[model samples]
Target: MRDSEKILDSWDAYSDEHTDLDGWPHDDHAYGLRASQRDADTVGAFEPLRYGARHLLATAETQLAQLPENTVQSRWVYQLGVLHAALDRLDELHEQWLVTRDALPATANPGTADFDDALAEHHAESWSYLDDWATHGKALREINTAAHKAPSALVNAPVRRTAAQK
Candidate 1:
């Protein structure tokens, strides 16, 4: 099974045990408003992205660690740096979103119109951070592809003097 399917199954099992009580509605629209609110909530929306980015950063760091010191290419080093920067940006964005969300009044519950309006406002602001994260991710992917294809590209090679200079 796909990883997401497995995760969903696990989640379903857990939810069935924990949330199926108290006659909670199980229809399609039962959690629609709350889900939408989460999608719009800065902290809620970015939490998954932040989690994934953290994993990516860890994987990149592990790969870097496994490379031998003498044979490690500059491109690979650059890729690691890019991953670090991207993860840092994601963290900053998540924190900023959390602050924004926390600043809201306690009355911003999912079903209320005031909360809906707040969601609409925050959603637009959140897009800028999302766009930046996407751009960083794209750059990292491109760098990784290039490094994989040409791991010895001119970055850390020693310069040689020409005959005229010699």
Candidate 2:
């Protein structure tokens, strides 16, 4: 059984890494793979996040499989899976941003339709992904916090209540 705190910490770490992508200047031309499409740091940062999300998704799936359906654990697992999926989707969106950025000419003007359109699409997608991440993150945090509570307000409430009476 993975501790809820550790799981939350993993998510927090990933979120911290995600900030790197969020503030990435697609049009700055000074950061990311824009200057060097093959930049190691640019690709390296995102790869781990994707891997972490995939790992969390797999772990949640396995845990969910071992447990019964329609249970509190099942719900937690499902939420965690959704959170991981959001992270994976963010990774995909970042890749698309990279592709579009690379396709535009170095002298591409933000005022021009071609550059503006591509950049706008990437920015919009990034914002959407960020929103999903926030939503899922809040859900997971609530679930984890509830799980860590001594009373165990979940399906095991009865067990705690019975133990308390004794």
Candidate 3:
């Protein structure tokens, strides 16, 4: 959607209008997922992915808020919050661009293992902004490969996770 590009570009203009946000330049935050190169398929696939990741990160944050500061889960929650906030904006752009796709070849996502693999990379990338850059970075690679081997049944399938996952 050209409008979507304009929206994200507006954010860039917004940043330039102000002094660099926090310690980093507005352009710094503008990195990743350049609008011009993104294909419809990219946007189609990314919309739900960004939405899901953002939602999951928010869930982690809320759960973390309920716990004590010293626990491991809390640590993950805090760390995840930092990571999540870091990538939330990029994911938002994905959501924006992806939502523009309505008529597609399939109703279900994860249309292919390749798509899933891309998502896995994207998910892990979202977490890399926090510390443990090595851990999260590796996770991105691991999941990216694993997603490719996903069962053919998963193609065109709705996301399936255990109840505990929710």
Candidate 4:
């Protein structure tokens, strides 16, 4: 098997063994998996990030769908919208990266300086999405906490009205 395949297979085994019922691994385990793949295969390493974005998108969609129509002031509704937007942007970037990677000649030399520079650029962009994702996640958690602990505060908070609502 190719090195990328082997790396992904190991990751699958580790994820299967470590993930909770929600399919989220502990932070340390996830960091370890990323560390193992970072130097080996950039494309293969991006699989987890893509999967995570998809998962969050689906979850946010579900949560938004489940909310009642009258929940205009609900913090969760707003937070889920933010989460969805962040995930969507991440997904778009991943697609662009795939197109760029696939457009490279199959016979390109991996050891060339040009190849190394391109790989570095792609890797940097890929990892940058993590910062955006984490920021959105932190915001979501804060919203959840506020919604639970001070429900009245969220209820009274002014929501941005859409043009339709205005």
Q: Estimated TM-score per prediction? A: 0.39, 0.42, 0.27, 0.41
Provide the RMSD of all predictions against the true structure, rounded to 1 decimal. 11.4, 12.5, 17.6, 13.1
**Top of the candidates by lDDT:** 4
Candidate 4 residue lDDT tens string, 9-28: 56568777877788776787
* Comparison by TM-score, 3 against 4, better one: 4
Better of 1 and 4 by TM-score: 4
In model 4, state the lDDT of residue 77.
57
What lDDT does each candidate get?
Answer: 0.53, 0.52, 0.43, 0.56
Which segments of candidate 3 are over 4 A away from where they belong?
1-48, 68-70, 73-78, 92-166
Per-residue lDDT value at 108 in model 3: 32
Q: After best superposition, candidate 3 residue 11: deviation in angstroms?
A: 32
List the candidate numbers ranked by lDDT, top first. Answer: 4, 1, 2, 3
lDDT of 1 by residue, 66-164 (tens): 444654556655655665664576566557656766776798677677666665555555544543444344444544444465445355578899999
Clash totals, every prediction? 0, 0, 0, 0
- Which scores greater on lDDT, model 2 or model 3? 2
- Model 4 error, position 59 (Å): 2.4
Badly placed stretches (over 4 Å) of model 2 are: 1-74, 109-113, 126-128, 151-166
**Best candidate, TM-score-wise?**
2
